[model samples]
Structure formats: C-alpha cells, structure tokens
Target chain A: MHPPRDGRGPADPPAERRVGLILFWLYVLLYGGFMALVLVRPDLLSVRPFGGVNLAIAYGMGLIASAFLLAVVYMVLRSGR
Target chain B: MLHETSATAVAIFAAFVLGVLWLSFFLGRKGQSASGYYAAHGQIHWFVNGIAFAGDYLSAASFLGICGMIAFTGYDGFLYSIGFLAGWIVALFVIAEPIKALGKFTFADALDARFQSRGIKLAVAISTLVVSIFYLIPQMVGAGSLIKPLLGLPHEVGVILVGVTVTLIVVTAGMVSTTWVQFIKGSLLVFFCGVLTILILGRGLAENTGSLAPQTLTVRPDGTRLVDGKPQERGHDLRPVGTIRALPERYGSRRETGALGPLAYLATLEDSRIVTWAAKKRVDAEGTHTVFTPTERSGADLLKPGGSFKGLTTGNLADRLDFASLMLALFCGTASLPHILIRYYTVKDGEAARRSTVVGIAAIGMFYVLTLYLGLGAMTSGALDPTDTNMAAPLLAKTFSNTLFAIISAIAFTTVLGTVSGLIMAGSGAVAHDLVENVLGIPMTDHEKVRCGKIAAVALGIVAMALGILFRNFNVSFLVGWAFNIAASANLPALVMLLFWPRTTKQGIIAAVTVGMVASLAWILLSADTFEKVYGLSREASVVPFSQPGLVTIPLGFFVLMVVSLLTARPAEHRA
Candidate 1:
C-alpha cells in the first residue's frame, strides 16, 4: 500500500529518475534540431529526400513517429516488476 | 455562407446531447465526498483516463481548426500537428510521475505541497483561473460558430447552450462524468476520422479541366449579398472550387489514380499541379467587395512550409522568429496547462499516471497522422466554402453523404463539450480548493467543499458564455495561441525549479509566476498582430519586435526564479 498523503512531495526512485532525465533531454535535442533546421535552412526543406516526398513532409512525420516510439521505450524501461 | 439546416442533422445532434446529459445524472450519486468530486476518488481505470486525456487535449481547435488550416494553407497546418504531439514527450518523461505524486485536486495543490505558504497558493491559483478562462474562450467561441451551420441557430444561443450543459455536467458528477464524456468523445473522433481517411484513399485525386473563372461576393451596407454580378439566392449559387489541374506522366493520360496507399498518395500529389485560391477585399460607395482569385501552382511548392507562413523561404528574419517562438511555446505548453496537470490526480499512483500518458500519446498521435490525409483530401475535393475555413472537414464529409456529415458534426460538438467541462472543472477547483480553503484559511467539511465547488462551476459557466458572445468575431485559433503561451510562461518555470532545485525559496516561486504571467500578457497586447487586429491601428506602431513571446518570456521566467532564490536563500545549514 502507498504511504499516507502529506505536504512534502514524494520522490521517485533514483534509477527511474536518472532514466527519465536522459530520455527527456534526448527528445529536447531531436525537437530542437527540427526547429533549427526550419530557421536556418528553410530552403533545403523543399528538396525531395525520399519516395518523391519533400524533406518537409518526411521530417515532420519523422518527428511525430519519434515521439511515440520514445514514449513506448520509456514505459518499457520504467514498468514495475 | 448559407447552410440549409437538415432535419437529420438536428435529430442526431439532439440524441448526442441528450445521451451525454443522461450519463451525468446517472453518475451523480457517486461524487458526494471531496475526493470523489475533485478526482473521482482516484479510482478511474488507466485506459479510460488515457483516452480522457485525448478528449481533454484535442479541443475544437485541434479538429476543426487544424484541419481547416491545412486544407487552406498546406504544410503550415501540419507544422502545428508536429509541434503539438512533441510536447507529450515532456509530459511522459518528466511531468507525469512527479505531478501524480504531488497534487490532490488543483494544479495549485501540487505547487503548494512543499511550501505550505499562503502566497504560493494565492499566486498559483490565480494563474490557474486566468489560464483556464483564456482557454475556455476559444472552445466556447468554436461551439458558437459550429452551431450556426449545424442547428441553424444564432451564435449566442449556441454559446449559452454549451455553457449551461457543461456546467450541469460538472455540477452533478464532477470529474467522474467529465472523464467518461471525454472517453466517449475521443473514441468516436478517432474511429470516424479513420473511416474518413480510408474513404479518401479509395477515391484518390482527379483533374478538372473546366473553366477556372473566380467568383466575387459583395456585402452591401444593409446586409444584402451579391455574387458574380447577381443577387445571391443560395450558397450553391457560388460554385465549389479547388481541384487538381494536371497529373504526372507516370499515369500515362489517366486523369484519376484510384485507390492509393498513404505514401503513394503524398508522392503523387507532389508531382501534380493543384489549384489554390487567394482572397482580396475592397471597400467603396457600395460596401465591402471580396474576391476569391484562383491560381495554379506545382504541387511541390504547395506541399512545403510557405503557403500560409509567408517569409519562411524568403529568409525574412521577423517572420522566422515568430514561427520559432510559437513552436517553442507549443513544445513546453502541454505539461504546464492546468487542466492537463489536474488529470494526474484522477489515477491511483505515479505508475498509473505514466502509463495513461503513453496511451494518450498513442491515440492523439494517430489522430494527427490521419489529419494530413483528411486535410489534403479536402483540398482537392472541389467543395470548399472559401468564406469560412472552419467548415472544411464537415463539408468534405458532405461530399460523401449527408448521414456521414451529420455524424461528424455531432462528434465535433461533443469535442467542444468534453474540453469545456475539463476547463471548468479546473477553474472551480482552483476557486473552492485553492483560494477559499487554502489561501483564505477557511475551514470546511467534505460536504461543504463539494457544494462550494458546484457553485463556483455555475459562476464560471456564465462568465464563459458572456466572453464567448463578445469575442465571436475573433479568430478561434489565434486566441488558443495566447492560452498556451501564458500557461507555459507562468506555470512551467515554477514547477520545474521546485522539483529539481532544493534551494528554491518560496519567494522565488511567487516572483516567477507573477513575472511570467504579467510579461507574456503585456507582450501580447503590445504585439503587431494586436496592433492591427485589436487596436485597429497600423502594425508599424507596435512596440514588440515579434508576436509570440515564448522564446523571450519563457527563459525570463527561469531567470527570475533563479535570481530570486539566490537573493532570498538561507545558509546551507539552515536549509530544510
């Protein structure tokens, strides 16, 4: 059973805490990269990178895919025994 | 635009609204205690809570607003989709577990848990109320706009109807009924949108080679409308526009490509030519003269980032900064929102909170992916109403069948209900739990607390209705942008520093919340967009360098918190 509720907030286990921060910064970098690309080299987004789809579509879809995958990974790593 | 009210639409809409009200009454007996009224006794199942997350997050702005933007502006709308989904990463990896462990009812509960200070409680509670009201305006305004076409009612009636119904939902059962309504709404939205995407893929794209003459609509001072040099009788008098002009040579003289895969659909569109429209308005002795001019462009350019976001490819510095600031706000806003924060208390434990967020991300991400196909399909459906872009998704369904259109419109209406109920629940909790009981130090029993919460819900509902009517003409999506920026600026820095920095003083948090809220609000009111749209003055007279304040104000929040903490910090031995 969980402990009684109180004013001071409870802390997560150390291993879980470390793992969460690592994954959190990893995603920050990925999203930051997308923004940087848009701001610095807006013209390059027009290039057809793959499957006759431009880099803009490919990159935008890739960011969405990455978010889901990273979330599933976090859940798997942090699941209870 | 004239929308002929269909009897079938009114029937389906009435059935949906009645069904939701019945569910609230059925659950009324379950919420008699403070915990039950606030967080459903923290006994809600993880899966239900997860989809309820989608229901709360995917507002009318996400469905009708994003789809319409994409249908009209191409890739710029999808940019919003990407930025929105990315914020869930911060929620899952950082906020989900800690917030679940911290709060009881309101977001203020979490922030004040460690401090137990009245100032902290007061500032956070006010921020919660302000953010909730700003967010509520867009949802209420969207409800008003949608009812005009679906029920043939005036905009004010729709706003009042939604306000009354949502208040009843909260006053009766609180979070129990709100969560269930969201679960039902979320399920139907994803399922129906999937069906629509499959239908779109099956039909594919076709070229229309008819005359490309544009139409002109002039509104006289006395409220008469003239279309194409003749008095407008019905909406159909102005013919539907938007079509593919030419296909790639790979099809070898074939005009339509029947039944396409998702990637193939995008690739095929990239190689074709599409017809897009541009609108111009002029005023003279008659009235306002509006013309929709059609122009053909290579699909390659249309699939990029410059259709609605001008100066993106042209290397204009001011426009790029505005785009970047908006994206930054969206990235950080999801975890900071008061309604989203309060949802953590509905589940049992930290583990449940984390798991439910994953489920939310999955459902929400899938819906966003399907939005691309739905918007692109609407772009080439040749049935767009050029005047009102918010009607794009429903009108696309109309091209298929009237029954489908009716069902989709009803689902969109429920979308408004679910989101507004969540916002009102957040606002009422802040008033009764945070302000009255905590800040003012008023003693109350469990029964008294529940009654106080119910009364607050009614007051907020009335306020929302009044603001919705007053701001009916303002763009719904533009107002939503203000909510996200303020939420991120005011709430995020305080929450992050409190969890991470042990030396954080109570004074620092109070400063951070106050500075972030005031600075962002001040910047928005002084922005160029506000100068032209709200103040009716020239854009050049504005003082702010850019419109979005996140790239500047969010960091300012962190800086203020750090400086205040250092100035007021205790010695190392005196800490804790």
Candidate 2:
C-alpha cells in the first residue's frame, strides 16, 4: 500500500530500533532528573559539589558532556551490533 | 550606548557577505533537479553535513542572544545552551536514522510516506510553515540588530539586506548552496569563539574601581532625545557597564586575578562580587523615558540559576511550571524541527544520518561549552552595552581589539545568514513540495518543482523581513523559545507514534498535528507575556497560567493521537 520512494534507506533494523528507543528513554530520565532537581532543591545546586564550581555549573556542564558521550556510545553500539 | 561604526567592521562584514554570495552563485548550476534543490542530491559527506548541521542549528539566538543573556543575568542564559544541545540527543537516538529512511524532500514526505494522505500532507505542511516562520523571525531580528552596530545601518535596512541575500542563495542553488554556507559559517563561528574564549581566560577577571553611574534616556513629545538630562548628542551617550566589583579575600588587595584556569576562574568568580544592569521604563505626557540602572549582584548568585528566569528564586508554582515547560520544549523540539529533519535527507543513508548527528552534537556541544566562558567574561569585562543584551559578545570582543570585534561581528552576521537560509528552505519546501505537489495534487516536472520552490523562498523572505521589523524590540532567544514549543507540540507526537505504533492511522496524525499546532499557538497568544508585551495590556489580565505551553500541549498531542488512532483503528490492523 505504501508508495515507492527514492533516496530512502532501508527501515531501521528491529534490534537497532529497540536499542535506539532504550537509549532515548535513558536520556529522558537523565534530563528529567536535571529539571526536577532545579525545581525541588535549587539551593542544593548552589552548593559546590567538587569544591570547584557550584552544583549548578557542574551539573549543567555535565549534561552537555553526557549528551556528547552518550551519542558517541550510541554510534559505537550501533556499529558494533 | 552608542557605536562609532568602525570602518574595519564594515570592510570585514562586506567582504564576508560578498564571499557567501559568490559561493552561492558558484554552486548555482548544480541543483536544477528537485532532489538536488531540496536535498542536494543526497550526496553530501556526513562530516560536512554534520558541521553544516551545527551551522544551521546555532542561529543568532544561540550566539548573540545566549551570550547577551549570560553576560547580563548569568547562568540563566546558559540554561538555553544546555537545553538546546540536549535536544540533539533526541534527534540522534529517536528520529535520525528512521527519518532518513522515510522522508524524501521534506518533513511532510516522511509523515505522509505510509498513508499517502493529502490531509496529512496539508496539515504537516502548515505546521512546517508555522514553525519555520516562528524560527525565522528571531534570526531576522538578530540580523537587524547586528547590522546596526556593525554597518551603522538602520534596523529595517539590515533585515531587508539579510532577506534579499538569503532569498538569492536559496533561489540560486537551494540545498547545495545552503549546506556549504552553513558549513563555512559553522566552522568560522566555533573557531573564532574558541579563540575569544582563550583570550578571555588569558585576560582573566579584573575589578573595576571606576564610577558605576546610571544612564537615563528620556524621549520628548517632539521626538527629541536626552541622555543623562542633556540633549542626545553623538559624543555624549550612555556609558558601558558590567564589571567585577571585588575579588575574594584570598587575592588580598589585588584588583585583577592575573590569569586563571577554567575551574579556577569559575571558583574565583563564585567568591567575587559583580555589577550588572537593570532597566526601568515609564511613559509620561512628555514621552517615554528609560533608565539603565547598575545593580550589584554576588558572583555566586549570578553563576547559579534564577537571575533572569526569576522562577527558581520566586518558588511560585506557575513560574516553576513555565521553566519546566520551556526545558521540555527545548528537549523535544530539535527532532521536530522541519529544517533539521530535512538535513537528514542531505546525507545518503540512515547510518550517515546517525553519524552526522553525532558529529553535529560534538561541534555544537563544544561551542556551547565555550559560550559559558564567553558570557562570564563579558559580564566582568566592563564593556557591556546595557541598552542591548544582543551586543554583549561583539562588545566583549571590542574590549580586546577593533579587528577582533570586526571578525566576531562578521561571523555573527553569517550566523544569521546561515540560519535564515535553512529556515527559508524549510518553508519553501513546505509550500512547494508538501502543499502544492502533494496536497493540492499539482503535477509538475522536476524543473517546474524547482521553479516553484524558488518563488516560495522569495515570498517567505519578504514575510520574514516584515516580521523581523515588526518585532524588532523583542529578544531573539525569547522568540526562538516559542518556535521550539510550537515544533515540539505539533510535530513530535505524530512522528514518534507513526514510526513506533502500528495502529496510528492517518486520521490520528492529521488530528494530532492540527490540534497541537492550534493549542500551542492559542496558548502563546493568550499567555501573560504576550498579553503584556504584544498587546500592551496588564499581564494579570491574561488567561493562561504560564507563558510556555509545551508541558501541557505536547502531552495533549500524544493523547489526542492515541484516542483518535484507537477510534479509527481497523479491526485487522488493531489485531496486528
């Protein structure tokens, strides 16, 4: 029933699709936790966890770092599979 | 504050614009076919496409706006950077490969692939147009703001200049030119910003012992202006503000902290005191009067959240919910954007799409990390243009050298150009490919399709210019936030369900897109912020509880899609 399409790749393999969704939810939880922390204990973010910068700066930068690392992980996992 | 309009800046900016236009013309002959026009023949290298993705994604809102926000208010601006980069995680894991597997020319192509429904095409096309225009407004506004300080031109002239140049780029070679322009611009932005960050780290934090006087601007009924109770004159203008008031006791009587490492810089700042600006406005029978007041805030307070956002510190439920909603929209919006979705098609395969996303994330993440330093540096540089937050980064560069300022400003202009062209490309595709050929059943050859798309691009350029000039006073990042909310609300639910759920009928997609778009739009138009800012009415008179609608509307989209899908489910399909 579907129309033929040009310049399209094969559908995502089922296993790869499953992995993608799993990773996707994992990220949602991580990001959601970040927002939740900001809402609940904003005072805690002001505390310097590592004796360097405060939790807010540390955690915010961590989020950016984590996204990039997770992306590299996904790419490696997909190719390894 | 006033600018002298440096000749070096004008020369550098003119050269950059000319280079981009020449590149567009040089690549003009290659993309005559619809595929090439829309997706650059699906032949771009993944690495190039990845950098181009960064170029396209980091608009004026990211560079000019976020830097300005952080320079003025602190970590609240970086929140936008974090939310923005976080959205790419969604794009990579959820939408990247699958979208490349489904769509041909536009986002509508991907959504309509299975159903072949004209209604789906029409609905998604309209959403694409709406989202693209919302996104375009900020880029154009940023363009106008950049032109004023850099070229000494009026705001309207700057908007038109960008509009005409971008339309020419799209009309000439479409995606071929667009992709290259983005790649070039993206490379330059990340590189120059990195250099600026290093310079900031080298210069370190310096305490200001100078006077922190406030500047007042009063507009008379006859259109005359006065600065500090004196008639507005070229030489007598508002003085620059924003500087460190004191360093920590560890530094003793030292006014400057020589040079510090990244973490040391931040820790030192956490222990320091800084001065920022607060603006107050009032209108009397004489005319409107504005005052730029300097307010001192602890570096610790500014480095943390809740300065500009105000929600975190207030502990009000509506404020918190508004902040949460904005974050959610930013997280979900990247995958839903039509311009970004089309970039997936510029690469050859699903794997390439995935690889390109990772590359984009790397480049974009690096730039964002550098933004923190750039903003914090500007905050204590004692050279901030308090009247305009959008000029913080450029002005920060000015403190170092005129040539550096010129280069930074020129790069920011191309940032606007790259983003605007990508947006216009998305809008034109929605009009020509989705609405005309797919929805209206207009039969057209490849040449005709390309011609139609070019016309649509020109039309969209004009509209964007008008909106830019109309909303000239609005902050660039604020407008972009609304675009994110709209994109997340209208596009995410349908795209996710279509790929994952077998029972998602065409009706569900159509209804979801329509309801989500309408609900978010209506919510925004009725929100307290819009009521006060756009309508010039009291904020308390607005109906919506909060400004951002994504927290409510994104879920509404999914809920509507589910109920409709179940109701319209075929018996055989339901059992499958």
Best by lDDT: 2
DockQ values of all predictions: 0.51, 0.54
Clashes of 2: 0
Q: Mark the regions of model 1 whose C-alpha exceeds 4 Å error after superposition.
A: A1-7, B235-237, B283-285, B573-576
lDDT of 1 by residue, B29-143 (tens): 8988899999999999999999999999988778887787888878888888888898898888878888888888989888777778899989999999998998999888888
Q: What is the TM-score of each candidate against the true structure?
A: 0.96, 0.98
C-alpha RMSD values across all candidates: 2.4, 1.8
Model 2 misplaced stretches (Cα beyond 4 Å): A1-10
True contacts kept of 2: 0.68
TM-score of candidate 2 chain B vs. the reference: 0.99
Q: Estimate the TM-score for candidate 1.
A: 0.96
Interface C-alpha RMSD per candidate, 1 decimal? 4.0, 3.3
- CA lDDT, every prediction? 0.87, 0.92
* Cα lDDT tens digits for candidate 2, A1-81: 122233243376677777777887888888888888889989998998766799999988899999999899899998997
lDDT (0-100) at residue B196 of candidate 2?
Answer: 96
